[model samples]
Each structure stands twice: as structure tokens, then as C-alpha cells.
Target chain A: MSNWQWFHRLGSPRWFYYKTEGWVPWLAAVSGILLVLGTVWGLAFAPPDYQQGNSYRIIYLHVPAAFLALIGYYVMAVAGAVGMIWRMKMAFVVMKSAAPIGAALTFLSLVTGAIWGKPTWGTWWEWDARITSMLILLFLYLGIMALQAAFQSRDAADKASALLALIGTVNIPIIYKSVDWWHTLHQPATLKLTSAPTIHSSMLYPLLTMILAFYIFYALVLILYTRAEILRREGRTQWVIDLVKEEAKKP
Target chain B: MHPVRRQRLFFILFIVFFSSVAVGLMAFALRDNINLFYPPSMIVAGEVPLDRRIRAGGCVRPGSVSRDRETLETTFLLTDGIVDFRVHYTGILPDLFAEGEAAVVNGELRADGGFYATQVLAKHDEKYMPPEVAETMAAVSDGHDESCEVVQYGS
Candidate 1:
């Protein structure tokens, strides 16, 4: 089909819902498998850093979580924008589904970074640029979630939250560039498309694999959450009622 | 304004206040990156230039630690495999620091490569020792004392 037609279909809640239903289980399975394999490869097989030795292994978890935290915010912001601009119900569903997950990933990044920092930088915390910006990102995610829950009307809440998300996007660039803009003890980017990786092949391979695995996991979870949101939002629809009844009939 | 718009305005104001404070702190701490990492061996070799912010790292020499009579300062020797350099700091040490432990000091190098430290970091925890230290100990201890106690210190 044409690109516009494909996008048009995606913009429809019913079409998006049915399409995702079939994909979620497979995506979840693949995500789980890749995550397990990648973690083992990173934790055990990867050679230790020449300087840091085994403690550097924490980067596998730290970097991936940080990457996902930033990416999740973008996902939320873009979804919010789409919902506001096009008045698409599915877009709202996506925005709502993304916030808590993004918050969780951001929290993971902060905690893992703190743990890794203790061994390498000698302190459990620093008010460094990247670290500080990431903390703000977490608060932004929390704010969106809280605003949505505080409102009585779902539509009004979604619109308000989306606007907040769009505004909060200013911090995303700040987070990405904080290492350069300010003096941070946190090392610069290890993986860059234009330059060679700073690490050895043995270590870099597993890190890349784990990053890919993280993206797949995000997609899998997003789909699952979106499906749940669909069920909750469309619970009054005949199809949803029928599905619920059919499931009830099952042994 | 609509209730949604009013709510958004409040959120925006809140974010603005926090972001400005974060940015202000970051700008104040800005410094050169290369100046931030130095091993004691590098310092002894006069590799770090004087009066520039740099980090010096090495194992804390077993018996070279002494406290300053006045001020929050302390003096100790940091040693890598081949060389040792004196480090002086006037701030709080990280919680994990102790004799024979690995550490990294951030500050400036003197003209003579003696490090005048602004910040100090103990390298690892009891559960997570730096590999460099473990390897050094392993090499030195070869078939000797295999029962050396792992070090831990409370902040």
C-alpha cells in the first residue's frame, strides 16, 4: 500500500488496535530472548576494561537504560504532539501508555548510573550536568503522569499533559549535550555513528547487542501497554465486551 | 484561559525554575576534560601540567597517610605499579578511602607534579574491588598470603 494510506490506517484506533494485538506476543518473546542473551554476553564473556576491570561491566546496564530514558521521552513527546494536532484517540493512548514506562526507565538509568559512578568516580552522586539533566527528565515524566491523573476529564487531561510534554522536550537536547556544554565527570559518548567506538571489540559487541535488545524490549512493552490502554478506553464497545465475554467462557 | 492551558502554564513555570538552577550549577563547574583524569604515575612523570584541574589515581600507599594539623586537608602518597606521587586535598574524602586502597584525585598539578587535590574518590567497594589493585596484589602475593582481608570503611 502507499505510505500515506499506511499512515492513515495507523491513525485509526481500531486498525492500530487489531494490528498490534497479533504483534505483541511475538515481540515480547523476541525481546525477552535477546535481553537474556545480551545480558549474559555482557556480564560474563566481555573482556574487562584495561583500567577498570570488572566494575566497568556495569556500563552494559547503565548506558542502555540511559539511552532508553531519553528515547522514551521523545516517544512520549511526539505521541503527545500527534494527539493534540490530529485529535487522534490512538495517539492519546500512546502518550498515556508511554509516560509511566519512560519514568521507570529514567529511574533505572539514574540508579544504575549512581551505582556505576561510585566505583569509577568515587562518589555515589554528583551534581554533574548529564546527571542533573536526567534527574529533571524524570521529574518531567512524573509531572505528566500526575497531571493526567489529577484531571477528571480524560480528554482535557490528555491535551494538557501533551502540551507539558512538548514544552519539556527542551530538556532532551540539554541532556544530550550536557557533557559538552558543561564539565561532567561522566565520560562522553562511547557509541557514535561517525567515529569508532572507544572500547575494544570484545566489549563493544555485547554493548551494541544489549542496546538493540533494549530497543526491542521498549517496543514490546509499548505495544503491550498500548493494548491494555485500548481495552480500558474501548471497554464499552461491542467488540471489547464480546472479547471479555468470550474470555470468561474459556475454561 | 482554559483550565488545561492554566495547568500547562503552572507546569512550565515549575520546569523553568528547576532547569535554570541546574544549568547555572553546571556552568559554574565547567572545566577541561583531559585535565580531569590522572594516575599517580602520570603525575610523578610530570605529565600533568601545573595549575590545571586534573584527576590523579593510584593505590593509596600502605603507610604514607597523614592528616593536616589545621584545615580539612590531608596528605598521602598514591602509587601505581612503578611510581608514587604525593597528593594533598582540603576537602572531604570519599567514603571508601583507606590505606592500600585504589583512589582517584581531582584537582590541579603543581609545577613539580605534586597533586594539590580538590576532590578525592576511593576506587571501589569491598564487594567491588578495582581490577588493577586485585591484579597487583595477585602478582605480589604469588603463593604467599592468600588470606589478606578485603578493606571496608564507613563514610
Candidate 2:
């Protein structure tokens, strides 16, 4: 019975709000410190490439943003599925919060990649398979966001956007494997789950740090957004009203 | 499980499965357009039409690049381990363009069998290393680095 307590409490908006409230400061501090450390190490300490030179340093940002964008889509889709199947409002709030963050990260990846590509690949943009598939991913994120806004009813919006998010997951595998499957100007991935990473240790370490920082940063932002969304959706509840009163009385 | 919940679960699964099948079929139908370039073997086999603007990519064959010096005209042979073809371009090459490195050229194949490229873009591999590591590997291997052997060509 005790084991299921946390799981049951996780579905409650009030419980989630109070549980994560104490974690906000810690999450912000850790992510901020790790982000600064990763960026400084990647830029100043890491060695230059033999070929691409300084332009290759952009991987610290580009790779992490791209990695999180793809992972965030899965988060959004799974949250939507949970909401649809289990009828959980918290899940729907999470799904909604994930959409804009994923879209922004995907946009970041594209812009950083274009900046890196101009000096290395001799072009700012191309309709190559990998690049085109990534662009499609960006559009998929935007489409989900747009679909959510189109419906006036929150319930209708959740259901419609959930369906679209699940459908768009098919594009994720395509984006990941496009470089390998097609003759693209975009190079293949440096990190592989099945084998050892291709990047050297000095470069790989900072990249791993940045990836960790991005994951922590994502968690912090998701929690903040979910907390705000919970308040909005549960405003009529007594606990939320009391919370608002408590906050006003503090100062 | 509740009957309604079970029914919704099945409905969601059905949508995902059928949508994946639909997308797979569409991807298969547009296969050629999705590939960025053709390899040398495809060009050698006459699978690609001549005199049409198309993209070709392969490793730049070592010791095959020649420059006119007076003009921007440069010629290089690109190889895919199986076949090799000559590419003629009259512009500045990219910074990363070098012997034994992968490159993609966009141009038309003349009836005379030479490819006249209007644009040349350098393509790098997945491997990354610091300058010192690369230099050490280059010295230890002495002109026979494993990086050159992993050149990927279009299938």
C-alpha cells in the first residue's frame, strides 16, 4: 500500500505542485551551474578540430538541443497517451507544457546547425535528406502546437493534439536514420548506443556534460511550466484558491 | 481493467499501427527523391540520365586532383571503392575539400562522360578528434589512416 502512495499522489495536481515547489531552487541551481561549466569547457578547454577547426565547437549546443528536441517529443506523446487512456489531467498538462519547449529546442538545433554548416559544408542550407527530415520535425512540433490552439475546448484540444503527436512520432525515426539511409551532405551521428562513441574523449566529455545540463534544464523548465498549468486548470479547486490567498498574505 | 479503458487502448493501438504503415508506403514511393545524390557506380552503370542536373558524391581519389593554375578550372576523380569518375569544376573548393575526403558535387554529366559541377560541397565523416590526436594517428599510420577506408558512398 505504501509503495503505491507516490504513484497515486503523482496524479494529483495539488500533490505535484507542492512536491515540486521545493525542488525548483535546487533544479535551477544545478542546471545553471552545469550549463556554465559545460559551455566554458567546450569552448575554451576543448581542442580545435584538425579540419573543421573552431566551427566544430558548436556541437556543444547543437547536439544537446537536437537530442532533447527528439526526446521531448516522446515525452509529449507519452504524456498525451497517458492522459487519453487513464483520463489524467496532470498528464494532459504535461503534454501541453512539453509542446512549446520541444518546438523551441528544435528551432535552436536548426539555427545552430545552419550556422555551423555555412563554414564547413559551404552552404547555409540544403534540401538534403537529413536536413529536410529535421525541418519536417520542426514543422511537426509547430503543427502540434497549432492544433492545440485551434480547439476552444481544452478537452478537445488535448485529444486532437495527442493524436497528432502520436502520428508525428513516425517522423522521429526518419530524422535519426536519414543520414545513414540516404546520400546526404549532413554527416552521421557521433554518438551511437550500440558501439563506442566516435568523438574523442576530450571533446566527448564536455559534450556529455552539456547533454546532462540540457536534460536537467529540461526537467526544471517542465516542472515550472507544469506547475503554472496546474494552477490554471485547477483554479476552481479549493486548494488552489487557498494557495493564491496564502501567497497574497505573505507580502 | 475496465471495458471502456480496454476499448480505448485498442483504438489507440490501431491508429498508431495503421498510421505507421501508411507513412512507410509513402516513404517507399518517394525513395529516389529522398536520396541526396547518386554514387559513381550508378553513374557508371548509366542508371542516371546524362545532361540532366543531378548530384553525385564519393571520396575524392588521392593523387587524382589537377588544377589549371591560370583558370579556376580544376579536375578531380571521385571514387566509391568500386568505380571512379572525373568531375570538372570551375570554382573555389570548400576548405575541407581534400584528397581522400568525401565530397558531393551538383552538376550535369556531359555526353562525353565527364561531370561538369557547378557546386561542390565537402562531406565529413562521423569521427571527431583533436588536432593532436589526428596528427598522432597520421604519423603512426604513415599515410594509411583508417579514416580514409570508412568513406561512405551512396547506395
Candidate 3:
């Protein structure tokens, strides 16, 4: 089949289930390997900051987690928009699966950031613009989750949640630019397109590696959750029923 | 609502409430980050121990600045007129570090009556004040007398 033919077939629940089952284990294995390598490289091998010393090592986890949190929200919002526009049930499932994961990542970012802040900034929390905005982002995610659960009908819930996700996306750019707009204590972006990194190559290498590892881990988890969501939503279909029958027969 | 639906809603609320409390506790546990600022008089009175990491804020006393060429350490006196404390810092001074300027230093106190600073922050008034400083100013200015005049220091 052509690529477009395969793409079109993916919308079919059975086709998606069969295609993703073969890929999930490999993706999970690769994600685990990369994460371990990245952590070791960042925590042990990388040199410490001249100013912050060993405490700056937290950046390896903190920065990647924060980056993923933001990106995950965008992914969920886009998926929601697609579901709303195309009236695709699978897209809605994907959005639903992505929200909790994104919120978890956002929570992780805030926690890790606080841990890092304690040793370096001598404080656990700051109402800095970026931090405050990120907290609001978490609230938005919870709002979507709550709105979805509030409705009596599943379809109505999905539609309402999708709309909320789309509207909340307006805050993303504001969160990104808050530091520049306000006189914040939090340092400006370390990685920027216009200028070279203010860090040594030893530190930069591990940071980049950790970022790649995080992306892979995100993809791995997203695919897993998507598969689970598809199973739960499409359990009444013949393929799912047959798969369940086959499992029971094996025992 | 159905029983299952109600339970799920309760579960989510539980998570939200529990997580919020956890976050609050973490913030309180890490209160050191929020409670860093101290006046020079507090340092002199032994209210703030010299060995502990603390921030000292006051005006730099004119003619009290000296530098050691061999050690790269600089010594200066900070005063609020009620009391004064000598601050000794080793390393490059902030650009704003000069005679008669408002400054905040983060470091430990020496066995002697001086501060061995790890970080030196120079603050200017409205022109170059950080957001935190601006917020602090706003909070303090709400009902207090406005005798505190912020001076411009290094860039």
C-alpha cells in the first residue's frame, strides 16, 4: 500500500491497533536506554557550573521536563483542534490521553525547578512570570480534564474539552515571553537561536543529549497511552473482541 | 451522576487537593529561599549569624572601601546609620559596587565581624530595579513612610 493509503487506514481502529502493537515495545526499549544514558552523562560526566557548582546538574532533568511540559500541551491542543475540525474520534481519544500526561510533566517541572532553586537561588519558590504562567498552564490542563468529565455524554464532553484546549493555547506564547516582558529574577533563555550558549561544551553536550532522550520518552509514552485509549474506546468492535477471545483461548 | 462517574470526580478532586497541599508544604519547607533579605543592623546585632548563608542589604559607606591585590578580596562597610557591618568579598565586585550605593550580598559571615560574600548584588532605583525589588518596593510603600530613597549604582 502507498503511504497515503496507510495513513488513511490508520483512522480505522483495527488498523491502528495492529500497526502500533508491533512498534510499542521497541519504542519503549529505546526510550529507556536513551534516558539512562542521558541521565548518567548529565549527572556524572558533565562539568559543574563555575558559579553554581554541582547544584547546576539539576538542569539536565529540570530543563528537559519543563520543555516537554510546554510541548505536550501544544500537542494536546493541536490534537484537540484536529478532532474538533475533522470530527475524528481517534483524534479526540489522542487528546484525552495526552492531557493527564502533559499535566504530570508540568507538575514534575515545577517540582524539579523548586529543588534546583533551593540550592542555587536560596529559595524554593518565586512568583516570577515564567513560573506563575506555567502554574496557570497546569490549571488549564486540569480545567480541560474536569470539563470533559463533567458532561453526561462522552461526545459532548470531548467537544467541550477540545474547545477549551484550543482557547487555552493563546497563553502559550505569553508564558514563553513573560521573562522578557517583565524584570524577572529567573535567568533568560540559555539556548537561543541568535546567540551561542553561555555554557561550556561539556555541559552543553549532556543537556542536548538529555533533551533528545526526553523527546523519545515522550513519544514512547504518548504512543502507549494512545494505544490504551484506543483499546478502551473501541472494545466493542470485532477486532478487540476477537483479540480478547484469542487471549482467553491461549489460557 | 452515576456511582462510577462520581467516584472518578472525587478521585480527581482528591489528587488536586492533595497535590496542592504537597506543593504548599514544599514551599514552606523551602522557606529559606523566600526569607533571604536582611538589613545591615540585623547583621551587626548578631541577629543573623555570620556563618550561615544570608543576604545583607544596606548603603555602602563612603571611604570605607579597600582592596587586597594579592587575594583579590575587597572589604567595605555597609551601614543603615543605626548600625554598620563590615563586608569582605573575594572575587570581582558587581559593576554597581561603589561608594554610597544600595547593595545586597549573599554569603557567610566570617569569624571576625565581616561578611565573606559569594554573590554581590547592586540595586538601582526605578531605572534598573528587578521585578522582585519592584514588588518589594510596592508592598512596602503601601502604608509606610517613604524615607527610603533608592540610589543608582553600577550597571
Using DockQ, give the best candidate's number: 2
lDDT of 1: 0.75
Chain A TM-score relative to the true structure, per candidate: 0.96, 0.97, 0.94
Cα deviation of A228 in candidate 2 (Å)? 1.5
Give the alpha-carbon lDDT of every model: 0.75, 0.89, 0.71
Computed on C-alphas against the true complex, the DockQ of each candidate is 0.11, 0.75, 0.04
Error of 3 at A75 (Å): 0.8
Off by over 4 Å in 1: A1-3, B1-87, B90-119, B122-155
Q: What's the distance in Å from true for residue B40, model 2?
A: 0.6
Model 3 ranges with Cα > 4 A deviation: A1-7, B1-155
Native-contact recovery for every candidate?
Answer: 0.13, 0.75, 0.00
Q: Give the TM-score ranking, best first.
A: 2, 1, 3
Taking chain A of candidate 3, what TM-score results?
A: 0.94
Candidate 1 Cα deviation (angstroms), residue A62: 0.8
Local accuracy of candidate 2 as per-residue lDDT tens digits, A125-194: 9899888878888888898889878999999999998998888888888889888787789988899898
lDDT of 3 by residue, A1-251 (tens): 48567546756767777878888888788878888988898778876553455767788888888888888888987777666655678878888888888888889889997887665544577565678878999998898889877999989989888777776775676566655554344555677668777555677878888888888888878888888888888999888899889989995
The TM-scores, one per candidate, come to 0.69, 0.95, 0.64
